[model samples]
Target: MIAAFLGMRLYSVLGRKAEHEEEIIQGRFKQEEEARDVPPPTATGADSARVEPVIAGFPPAIERGLREISTADRNFELIGFMEGAKGAYEVVLEAFWQGDKEELRELCDDDVYQSFAAAIDEREAMGVTLDNKLIRIEDSTVHSAQLDGKIARIAVIFVSDIASVTRDKDGNVIAGSLDDAVESRDIWTFSRDIRSDNPQWLLDETDIG
Candidate 1:
């Protein structure tokens, strides 16, 4: 009877200890799982306050104009605008060469579209086609930027190498050679109405850089 009583006392103590250890291990595993599930911390207001606005590399006058434009249009981003301007330059040149009036109409304002259309008409009358290829854009920069009331305008200067050939109706190369690339510098202005919901900017003006 004494032996049986000792055995029961030992079993009770050991069982309670084992159950407590199991509960502790289970709790630890749960804590580890929760830690793994936690998301990374986002930037807080104080952290964001430490960040500065990016400055566009330009002259003082141009920077002031850009600032005004930025104030007028909250969504205006200089880098994005520069990229878009470069793309537009290529697209407009290609469209003009191919005499794609519909595409030019969408990209240019009324006056600019009229100018491109007139050039296309003249080219068609001469029975000459432009076989032009934009080799590469060497440089592109914002020459000027301004906010005129609700309309924001930005002019970009693009320097590019282009291989151009004038082909006659008989497919004869007449003027330029494809082997020779010419450096073309052009200033193109893009304008947008900040109050409008449309995010697109139209080519409003063009000039030799």
Candidate 2:
């Protein structure tokens, strides 16, 4: 099941080459310097009733939820959050494949971290290692967004192509092929406390889309 879910398809010449390069994991939620410096909008007595502009094209429910989240957290920006989510997806996948538990712990919530750690432990017991490559990300969009009190959760649907291979202790390919890439659709939810000073969001849930 894992093998079947972890194959990739090349989207372009550049993507094909990128699949072979070492994964560069950077700050998962780092925003640009200029973006960070910009202060959140403040409403005085007259402008207190002003409603934030909602981005169109999303479903009514999603739009409502996003608006609620934005209201709760003045620093929330849809475009920047989506970009950061995409980067987080790549970083988390590569860290899991490399069995980097420390990195995974920092990127994911406790429950999610435990799930990934358990999978790594199982693979180690079997004397097998995953060789997975994210060939291309075809799409990454917000599927849902909601705010519960000061906690905001956003689920993103990621449509990506991955190449995966399982190697035995002797370095022989035991399952999957790197040449064949398959599309995978995953819904991953990230959550953050709007009241917190830290701007980082942690992966809390994952599902097949």
Candidate 3:
């Protein structure tokens, strides 16, 4: 009779403890499910806005240069050469957008290439960050041309803005500067001769201010 009484008490105590543990586990599971159902915070301000489209186009004179795009004759190839030069200009725009030096080198002439590369190197050395937000081919005009002689000159205008942030050696931003989104128009001259086997014309010169 004594043994039966002690066994019954022990069994009652264990059953209650098991029920308490089960309640704690169920409570924890409920809290976790509630957290999972909660929605994430929404983004605000400009961060939520859509990005603007990139715009690029050439002037009327480019069509005139395209006249020589024919491969049948050397004279016609001269026109192709001018068109090729224009294409190089477009390539430079792409490089600026992508922040790539190699791409610029392929399209830029020796002197111009050195100037641009040096600027990039200096900025990198000083921890300066550069951002080119916009590049637009605004206008272009034909300066002079001699299609029969396989030589042409054209002026292309482009507008672009650059933003720079200067940083210290420790990579801390010190000075930030932005060129007031000014209208920058560049005039690029192109020339080539018929007798020259070189189908691609050189960038004779450029006036950028």
**Which candidate number would show the highest lDDT if scored against the true structure?**
2
TM-score of every model? 0.74, 0.77, 0.45
RMSD of each: 32.9, 9.7, 31.9
**C-alpha lDDT score of every prediction, in listed order:** 0.64, 0.68, 0.39
The numbered model that scores best in TM-score is 2
Q: How does residue 103 of candidate 2 score in lDDT?
A: 71
lDDT of 2 by residue, 35-86 (tens): 3232211111212133344345689999889888877777677766776788
Candidate 1 has a TM-score of 0.74
Error of 3 at 191 (Å): 4.0
lDDT of model 3, residue 87: 51
- Give the Å error, residue 48, model 3: 54
Candidate 1 residue lDDT tens string, 148-185: 88778788888999987777788887767789998878
